[model samples]
Target: MNDMKELRILADACFSAQVGQALKRFNASHPEIQAVVSIAGAKDCLQQLKTGDVYDLAILADSGVAAAMMPDHTDGYYVFAGNSMVLAYAPGKILNAKNWREKLSDPKVSISHLEPNAHSVGYAALMACMLADSVAPGMSCTLLNHPGRKVVAADAEVTDYAFAYRTECIAKKISYASLPDTMDLSNPAFNAHYSTAKHDLTGDGKNIVQASAISHAVTIPLAAKEPEAARDFIEIFLEHNFTAQGFQPRSEIVGKSPRRIHAALEVRKPPRVQSANYEDEADVHLLQRARLLHRQQPAAEAG
Candidate 1:
């Protein structure tokens, strides 16, 4: 495989910039390999793997995904990053955003969650159970089911429920709430590597509760003519610095770790001393989990 080539990357849209931003700096040194990315749903990345799309790298939920591929002697799954599961609230869900604690005491908090089929969202549900056990002893928060874009807006009021990563909720500007860092569950970490590559490209997470694995699976088609070059490109992404472009840091693969990795990372560096006017960093808190978006689709009437 020639060292001079750009690898085709297929990652979840969530981490599309992770690869791009990190690679921007890497390109300065390794001018040979170019990075071409194809963004899709994490589930779709799995389908692409099974169908032989031949990508150099991919990102997916850590424990939420499972797929079968041929055992390529040269490739394997590498743990690269970890994101925690945090409870986020849609601004629309809260009846009184100003008094969130009082609102939670209300009998009608409608939390939005992806269908259980969403691997990451499913793990988040598991965390909710843990949280319930610790808080009220036996009381449980109802995990409402909704579609990716489907929502059950309050008939005359607002619902209260948010699940997913902080990055996602903030990106959409939803009303978000999170647990203290001490309660984070950092076990399930993300994994990815070329089916034939030797390393993974990830730094660490600033978010803790939903710190699940995003295993980016990249598979070479059985008939891929340039398997060697493809493998080389995967190596570049793993070892290169693509984070300068706003790629959220993944402590595991990069360098930072511990549950506070994300929290600690959030501290402004020396160069950016001033605050208040800075642009928002999506999913800035590593100690928190993400809030998954879910809403029900209106059912169609039978003709």
Candidate 2:
């Protein structure tokens, strides 16, 4: 037991389960390293870090990493992957096509969303609703009052629909409507348009601006108990796990004084494969569903 190296990680719920499974596979190859991973909302993860709890590594949304960096809590930060927002619903509970927006606005339709002030997904959901309202005028107010609930809980509680990650819906095998670039927070081209939409969490008129894309960021905290092991784990993750799990790996680095590491941050683009690549089969299916749902629908449709 003395020879084992313990590495602790705190990450947002979207990435935690998959990452924990990946770490289990990693441990199989390196028997000397033991990794413990905890997944929660971005705010909860950040709160744990701020309260003096030591974690070797942290995987959070861009905003959470920025919060940690402000106080010099992290040694460096790296952009690892990206995700987009979607509206998930039980199969057949909600229609997939043209009437989706109308369905959400219906008083009888039970809608749920994460807490906007606590999770990145929640913030993105709020932004998506705001964007929808831009074209429809009242859509934002309807969604803002959606009962706050975790995605999993909402699913079990029979929520008609909820805002969620495109990848997450696919991962959970749920039917979802793929949101458009303007409302999904996936396209950087819509950054200015997205910036125009904001929501006040405190209900006191202070607006919290949302980013256009959901980029996953990682960092090694200065208070880490085993920094080198944490760094090694990140290298393994980047080299072997991310792409396989359907995330678009970022090539560029973003952070304040990022620590130099042996791992190459940039993943080389692979040659395009023509055949049915199982690695991205789920992603392709989700996109196709999104297209089918949005085809011929008005721009004001809920995503």
Q: Of the candidates shown, which would achieve the greatest lDDT relative to the real structure?
A: 2
lDDT of 1: 0.40
The numbered model that scores best in TM-score is 2
Query: What tens-digit string does per-residue lDDT give for candidate 1 at 1-303?
Result: 666566566666555555676567556655766666776654465556666666544445442232333343112343444444455554444332223335554554554545333234443444443343222334234322222222332122333555555455444545455432222233232111011111111113211222233333333434444455555544554453323321234433222111121232232222211111223332432312231111111222322
Count steric clashes of candidate 1: 65
lDDT of each structure?
0.40, 0.65
Judged by whole-model lDDT over C-alpha atoms, candidate 2 comes out at 0.65
Which residues of candidate 1, in runs, are more than 4 Å off? 1-6, 22-34, 63-75, 90-105, 118-131, 144-160, 169-175, 180-184, 187-303
